[model samples]
Target chain A: MKVKTKHIMNLFYIPALLLFVAFVVYPFTQGIRISFTNWNGYSQAYKYIGLDNYIRFFKDKNVLGAFVNTIIYGFGSTIVQNILGLAYALFLNSKFTGRSVVRAVIYMPVMIASLIMGYIMYFLVQYDGGAINDLLILFGKAPVDLMSQGPRAVLIMTLINILQFVGISMVIYLAGLQNIPEMYYEAASIDGVNAWGQFKYITLPLLMPAISSAVVLNLIGGLKLFDIIMALTAGGPGYSTHSLSTMVTNMYFRGQHAGYSATIGIFTFIFIMIVSNIIVRYFDKKEVEM
Target chain B: MVQNNKRAAIWRTPLAIIIVLIHFAPIYILLGMAFKSPKDVTSRWILPGYIYKQNFDIAINKGNMLAGLYNTTIITVSCIVLIIVFGALAAYPLARNRSKFNGGIKAFVLGIMMVPPLSILVPLYTVMAGLKGTSTYWGIIVILTAFQLPMSIFLYTNFISAIPTALDEAASIDGCGPFRTFFLVILPQLKPITASVVILTGINCWNDYQFSLYMLQSPKIKTITLTISSFFSQNSNNVNAAAAAALMGILPVILLFLSLQKYFIKGMVDSAIK
Candidate 1:
């Protein structure tokens, strides 16, 4: 009976495992293989020119730009998101009426897909009669064409990304704040710790676990930023706002650079693997000490 | 001290309110302008003088919003149901059995949760095409299921393990087989995690654009996200109609979120922090 029950339990795993292997493992391996080739994505004939695709990718100006932009997007958004999120979470942790409503409102953007949010942002940022420009005109100031510049466009993209996701970090931080014993705060208050001191010594230390998770999750999400960039800028005013993910999509779908696209994908896979693992390890150690 | 606390609330609450308002400003613009005519939408008016019904008509008739909505509903519902069922079932054995195999599977699922789907985009699309999965509802469903499975399983397994082992023993002693015990005794107890899985996966599959962009390229099979996206690009000149399409497309998901926000927020925090 025990053996049969064990077999049945294993049987339950078969469907999920099969689909996972086929869809995830198989394609992942194929992506690696195609990266070493010189396939144009149309004709069946192609040759594996070892390391040439990776070599070209390293040399390509656009690829390098995208790599840098992805890093900026990831780190830039992660930093801003954590700071703002922690602040909001701390504020919301205080007693107030309509608190849940406020949290839901703040988190509302997180529910909207980034792709749609990007489209809405485009309307607001457009130069001619855009909402932001119109608001500026109302204020008797000259309108700024924000998205026209490469750096500014990337900055706005990062800001938009931050706005959409900060609530997630906030919610996470709030959960962490809830986990801390109230007696700690009470004891600190009795001992005459200032707000800043209490926060620095009590809240911040207690919140480290939440901080690590939020930062790493946000970092991963920001690195994978694509739909928003695609919808808002299409990696332009030029290729200035392109992340590696968007660049891969563009290379494969539009530019007909299949092998090159796979190479970028592989590069992204390895890079993300290294970066995220390093972050997770670093955080795991911090969490233990805290 | 009480007075000081009151004073702090006065400033803190309003500041929090401002932050939320700022976050929602774009959505407000999107909805406000969606009802205006093209001229009024582009103008400096905060709200339209009168609502124009033509925007919705145009969105439905021309922008493919209706067909997209229909397809999106089918896909989202089907995907959510399958995710919950499969995720719970797979998580069960892993949660109950303490073996090296289960341990490896758990770790692999967690690792897959971190992998960016874009890393395998080209090959996944190619393989899907070979299987004739592109442009088909089931194909996209399968892909979404596979991609979302790791997270689903992780959440479910964690939740299930917290449930007591005595329930399984109780069911088995009552003359139930493993499958019957699972379906009858264990499955019903999985409501909370199942709710989490539903909201998380529903929002994901509903709002998905990247996969739909490549897989469901055909006009007839386009999801609401794809429809709204293509409409925005094609009709950039007509701001009102585009906003209308966008508004209509997002309304369902927004409504769903609003209704289940308690679960939604809890699920998010639960899934992430674990």
Candidate 2:
């Protein structure tokens, strides 16, 4: 009877497993295969280029620039966004009126699509007739070229992302805050612990799970950042803000070495997998400790 | 002491409100731009006293915004339905049984979630093109479902595991088969999580631009995001018209989120914390 029941369970799982292998597994294998070929993204006639594409990618200045910019953007966005988000979360977690309204308002930017946010920011940051410039003129100060400059353009984009996505980290922190028992704070207070002391010992330690999640999410998002870059500057002013994802897409569409673009994509995928696994494992261990 | 506490509370409340206002200023700018005329948009800081219907009218008429709306609705709804159905069905055995196979399957799905969509974009595009699925609604729908499956399965598996197996046993003893047991016994218990899955997946499908841009080239099959992008590219000078189009594009998603805010918030928090 138990054997029959096991057979029935296997029957139920077979179809789903097949679909998984076909849709998820097959394409991943095919993607790896395509990375080795000189396929022009359309034709089947192409040679196996061996490690040449990977080698060429290393020598390419644009590819190197994209790599550097992507890392900088990812690191910058993750650190700034998390810090700001945590600060905001702590502020709201305090005893206050209109906390719910505050949360709703803070989360508003996150609700809008990134592309729309990018377009809106473009108008706001443009040199002439932009909202920022207009405000600057009103203040009797010279307007700075936000999108035309090199590193500053990327900085401005990162700042916009920080403002938009800080709400996600804040919400996660709020969840972490709720999970901590009030007794800890009360006990600390009895031992002559001030507010900062209680926060340092109780809040910081207990908030590790949320912090871990926020870090993982922000890192992944920042690394894969493309939509906003596409809309904001189109990786513009000579690819100053070009991310790996955007560069891969541009190269593929521009019809200049599809295999090389695939190689870049493969490298990015492996890099993300490594970083994410490290973060997830580290956090999982920490969660077990807590 | 009482006076000091009151003063602190007063200061904190106003400060929090100011922070919230600053955070939401971008959305207010979007709304403001949507209502301003093209000329008024040049001086964006100043409030426009009147609604500029011309931009909205032009965006709809010239941009074929209605067609884009139809395309977005069809794709989002279709993809959401597939994700819920297929994801729940796939998650059942993993949740019910405790074995290496089931554990392996669960791990595989989780691993797929980490692979960024950009990594698979080129190959997936090729596959769709070869199958002659590009430039069609079904193509985008299929790609959306495939990409969204891992996360949806993760969510469904987590939710389904919380359900007791005794329900399945009871149904089986009553002569119910596995399929019947899932639909009648287990699926009803999945409503709350299903609501969460629908809202999250629905919002994602509605807002996706990359897949649509790469897969669909025909204007007839364009989704709202694609249409909005094309509109902006074509009419770079018409800021009000662009803003109006953007507003129209996101209205459905915003309304959906607003109406289901409670469920959406709970679902998101629950999924993350889990």
Candidate 3:
């Protein structure tokens, strides 16, 4: 019976394993191999120059800019998302009339695709006839062209991303808040611990696990952000706003520099692996210390 | 104390209402503008004066929304089915066994969840092109299922562990085989996680843009996201029409989410903290 069970267990693993190997593992290994060659994405014949792509990455201005922008976007959005999400979560956790309605409205955007949100925001941020501009003009102010400048465009994209996703962290944090045993708060209050002290000492410490999850999830999502950037900026204003993910696609599909694009991808992979590990470790340590 | 509590409620209630309004401003503009006539679209009117139903017609007819909807439905449904079935099957063993092999597989799936999909896009594209899988529903469907599987497996494994091992023992004592035990006993209890998996994967597949953009570039086979994006770029200046098209594209998913709000939130929280 034991042998039969083990065999069936092995059998159950086969389908998912095959799909993962074929699509993910195989493509990743091939991506590594392709990055080393000047293959151009089409012709069979190509020459490999060891470390040439990696070496080129160090000197390429656009790549270096993209790397910086990626970090800024990653950390920038992650920080804002956590702060706002936690605030919203805390607010919603308290009793109020129409709380569910408010929660639904805020959380609705999280369901919509970021790509769609980007397009919608494009209308809002444009100089002419934008909803924002229209509201601005209603206030007797000049219409600002928010999308024309590179750095500004990047900021808008990041903000749009944060707006669309804040609800996710909010919902998660709300769940965490709900899960906390009410006894802790009651105990703290009985001891004359003020609201802020109770929050700092009991609430915050107890919520570390939720904080860790939210931080890591948002960081990874922000790091790998593509759709919103693609729809909103398309790495425009001379690639100034491009994150590494968008830059990789722009390099390959439009630029046709497949080999170099793969190099960008490989670099991004390594960067994420390193950054995510550090974040997970840092959060894990904090959780333990608490 | 009663006065203080009442005062706090007064401030907090209005504040909450304002926050919801601000957060929902974009969607409000999208819907409000979508129904406005062309001349009225750019105005500061918070609400449209009249219901302009023709915009939906333009979005549906001009944007090829029917085809987009068809393609998106097929892809989303297939991806959800595969994710649930395969993810659950794999998770059962990983959750049940205490061996190094299962341990390694669990770790591998978790690791893959962290891999940025963009890193592997080029090779994935090439492989799909070589296999003639590009532009086909199955082409994109297979890749999405693979990418989404990790989360499903992770969630399902965590959920499955909560099921007592004694259930498996009881099944074995009855004359049930391993597969039957899982199907007859274990699978039924997975309804909650199953709902979670379905809600999460459904939204993902419906909303996925990057993979569909790369894989399904053919004009005839665009998903709703790609279709709306393409439509907006082509008619960039037609704000009313673009807004209409955007609304049309997102309405189905919005409806789904609204209807399944509880399950969706449960799924998201379960997947993340696990």
Task: Please report, as a residue range, the 10-residue window in candidate 2 chain B with the lowest summed lDDT.
Answer: B265-274
A250-281, model 1: which lDDT tens digit per residue?
99989988989999998998898899999989
**Each model's TM-score, in the order given?**
0.97, 0.96, 0.98
Chain B alone: TM-score in each candidate? 0.96, 0.95, 0.96
Model 3: per-residue lDDT, tens digit, A39-113?
Answer: 788778888978898999999999898898888888888999999999999988989888988888888888898
Better of 1 and 2 by TM-score: 1
Report the lDDT tens digits of candidate 2 across residue range B1-274. 4686687787787788779767766666667888987766457766678888888998999988999999999998999988888888888877877689789878887787787778777787777888899999888887788778777887888888988788888989998888788889988898888887887778778888878889999988988888889999998888889988988877776676667667767665665666
Which candidate wins on lDDT? 3
Fnat of all models, as shown: 0.62, 0.42, 0.76
In Å, residue A199's CA in model 3 sits off its true spot by: 0.8
Ranking by DockQ: 3, 1, 2
* Docking quality (DockQ) for each candidate: 0.69, 0.58, 0.78
- Whichever of 2 and 3 has more lDDT, that candidate is 3
Cα deviation of B46, candidate 3, in Å: 3.3
